[model samples]
Target: MDQTRIGTFIAVLRKEKGLTQKELAEQIGISDKTVSKWETGNGMPDIAYLSPLCEVLDINVNELLSGEKLPSEEYLGKAEENMKHLMQENQNNKNAGRWQGLVGIALLAVAVFLTFGLSQAKIGWYVDCPSIILIVCICAACVLFSGCRTKYEVVHFLRKTVLPAGLVVMVIMVPALLHSLSDPAAIGPNIAVMVLTLLYAAVAYLVLYVAETRMERRRKQN
Candidate 1:
């Protein structure tokens, strides 16, 4: 199941039908950009879209999976090959995700260390640097990796964690920030502190939203 070969097949089919990329995408209820990506081999169509797309293009799903026209007798073999390719791809993605998860945890650990080290420094009298860093890092990590799960038995975790914990940190920060801003020297750092907090919140929400939407699409497909 070579993407480039499959993409070329899709493009040829669409052109033979006298349909523009936008026209084909309209029929499939997808963006023209997605159609373009498929044709250009920049990305493969999602599995969920494959059936509808094959229907629109008047091609058998096994033939599309094979990236070529296949004889009826060859359908099972082609499908088996496609399944193997898909499984390998899934495993690769999972490995990559595990590496990313490790990196994220390492970052959190460094943030914790820095927070404690900063607390020991004599540089600030108004701000609780350690507390702020700890709260922000923990919240951001939670939001970013909220979808990660462990094989556990009975506890409902995410509902009692992540967003609620974030809210608690925000509540605590309000008064802490107010007090810190009362000092003239603390004004500059406090402004930066506010910006960092907002930036983290924005990024976390964006990542979470994108993750959730992709998960929903996959679930619908399944």
Candidate 2:
């Protein structure tokens, strides 16, 4: 709906409010680059940011979406239309996420089934190689399909996934580590890999926790 026009209107509103891009971004808990993108029509603000963005710009949602101020008589009708559109978009996104989750689960189930069948058939590398490929494929599919729409949602997803992801990493690597230690030639490299992987996973969890905590603090402050 005239994204360029809306962007220009956002810039105008920001200027009218006597706020710099960085200042507005700080108030809204986003980066200056993100604010610039919104003002330049390179991207739209996330739906989660819409309310705070409108607040900081001293405008209402209808005015923001319409790319201009509206008279009192037109306000209700325009706002209603915008709200309907927003609700539909939200519903579509939710449905897409549900489908993605289901597909991911199905892929994992298929991978498990195939691995079991191959192993039972007494195949050597056939079981090992295809299982690895299937696992990798499932991971790629999940990464592509399970994208979050906003920074907060990303942080939330990370927080929820960190424990399970860390556990999975350890479960896969620990056994390999033990197996490697049994081989004299591979001891040094295996130890190094195991240590590094564990350290990296720990650091990832720590960073995610800190970031999520900070976001929570900011939300409470606001």
Candidate 3:
């Protein structure tokens, strides 16, 4: 009933057979321009030409009309199973993303409190210790959140294994950086923390870049 869709399907199959518009038209006994119009969905082929056109394309009548490749019974069952799995995966990803956002916001609030409250209180060695720890924890959280937003391919394994590794590094670095902030002699650790924070932000940006690349590839493939 959808003549435009039918025409488009015919055009695609014609091209896949490596036949030019003129060649296809001649083989089907139609004007070359008529093939062009059909391919462009501007017009439909005459009912009389439909059967012979399918014969030339080496496709069945149903295939010509539907445009979907006819799958074997076994393949159709597998495809349905895969579709269900993909739908469940998408739902899980959405729930995980929501939870990650909430946790990241909570961690950021804690970081802000430690950075401002402790630094201003000027508790020589004690306050700086916790402040540095909080900042490093924030950085680790940002990395985890970035992984949550990244595609299944790049971050999938890393999110499960390597992200927790980052937490360990954060635990060691934060207190050391905070301790350095209290002592004028050890300013290097404070500077290192700033540099590491910048790098973490850069990593987050890289994740977005990777995600965009994956999106573009999917668009083209589709």
Candidate 4:
């Protein structure tokens, strides 16, 4: 879908209807900046606002989505095209989400390692370090990947066996990491930690996934 074309079409139609950005936004129950964002191709209208926007612009949903005025004959074709674009966009977003899940686990491993592994050193007190950043990154990534908004939900998801399993791996890996870090010729030093962490992570995730699926099934039966 050509966002710029759609934005321009929206701007032109608004003007043709003798409405300013603010007037159009007021009619559609959105802020002027939101309308401006659409007009500038910086954002698209929310799905909730699409119907209202179509009404105000005197256009059909297909036309608005297609970013062009359509003849009666081309309307169905445009609708199909728009549907394909939406599906492809959805697939891309889900793929990006998978990447977030991967990163979150990797960061979780690093955070657990550095947070505890560094204790073996001569440091007296724990201060700010890269591990803090790792934790923060993983926390933010978890919210995005898991869609867990509430604190309780996030905590519940993290405090399950998945985290404990990771911690166990990290603890066991620490002695190996310490020894390897000291050896100049240690082949692929951190590989064991990363592999064990990822292995445990995969197992934990599979267990949690099966548990959730069963719970969902039980809910449906009840």
Candidate 5:
């Protein structure tokens, strides 16, 4: 459900009742700031105020909660069905993210193979260092993603595993990059490896950000 829409509904209801926020708060026994927060979608009304708020607005609790006005029985039934579909879609998205993480690991494995076999003959030492770091990162990400399915787990794993791994990779890769800048022969491959590793790190951070945002919004809803 959209909290913003609920807030908009409340604002409209307040306007219809010809009541300012202060007046609404006075009638409902809440602070004006609480009413403002509800109207602005910054927060939800407390459970104890729900019934009284609806009463003052001359609307049903369901309508207030749902941000809809006396929806027909058939419409309510269809909305419930749509909500179930949305839940299923959310589950599918979570599964797809997991699958994508596995795909990333597979790609990292292939990169490791190519690094050891092809790059070893030309840039053996530099390639081995970053390759090992990349492998560790990919493995750690996969393990954390697999073992921790919830938001808390995701946040903890990112803080304790992903961030540290990324910092280590950067620590190793950065000096190698700086050293390679003095040698034209080493510059191309060094830059390419750095770019790829940084890209992967960025994607990992984005995934965590999205997961955490969804979790926070869900937390608010509950």
Candidate 6:
């Protein structure tokens, strides 16, 4: 959209209607300064103000966005152009969401590998510490990524990502657990760490679910 052209159109329409900027602004419930800004190409109306402004100017929203007084015969063409622009914008957003999902999955996989590596070592609470931090951080990244807009999508993404990777960690840990079981000094502590890791993973899943649900609600409201 061309702001300057739209502003000029607004100014021209106001003059043709024989109304001052202040009077037009009054009808639209905005300050005269806002009308001045629009006319001078310094600003555009908010989404909420678009309808009222268009009504006052005797123009449709498409004409306003296009920055012109469209001819009757060209109206449909202009509307079609606007629709394509909107669809392109939506496609771009979806592409961004896909990128975020890929990154989230990759991060989750890395966290899983780190946990698996830690399981083979004799580190005490450090195993839980770094793994817990990674789980928390990755969960936050998932929520922030905007990759899953619906509950089903969110769960599917987690299942495809977290569950498979988690299973790999478990599969690799089985042999280690078996070996540790034969060692009296290692058995109890290793089981305790595994239990703590699983508990933290569950908590991470819960946090992601709640955060994503809140975000979805907010997105819908907006």
Alpha-carbon local distance difference test for all models: 0.70, 0.71, 0.62, 0.71, 0.72, 0.72
Candidate 3 residue spans exceeding 4 A from truth: 72-222
Judging by TM-score, tell me the better candidate of 2 and 5: 2
Better of 1 and 4 by TM-score: 1
Candidate 1 clashing pairs? none
Candidate 5 yields a Cα-based lDDT of: 0.72
* Cα lDDT tens digits for candidate 3, 72-189: 6545555565456545655665587679668967987898789767777433422344434554565556566665654544444343433344445556566677777779878775
Residue-level lDDT tens digits of model 4 in 135-178: 34554566678888765465457545455455554565567667
Error of 1 at 15 (Å): 0.8
Give each model a TM-score. Answer: 0.62, 0.55, 0.31, 0.52, 0.40, 0.40
For candidate 2, the per-residue lDDT at 110 reads 88
Write the number of the candidate with greater TM-score, choosing between 2 and 4: 2
* Model 3 TM-score, 2 decimals: 0.31
Q: Which of the two, 3 or 4, has more TM-score?
A: 4
> How well does candidate 5 match the true structure, expressed as C-alpha RMSD?
9.7
TM-score of 4: 0.52
Error of 3 at 167 (Å): 99
TM-score of candidate 1 against the unseen true structure: 0.62
- The predictions' CA RMSDs to the true structure, in order, are 7.4, 10.4, 17.5, 13.2, 9.7, 12.3
Q: After superposition, how far is residue 35 of candidate 3 from its true place, in Å?
A: 1.0
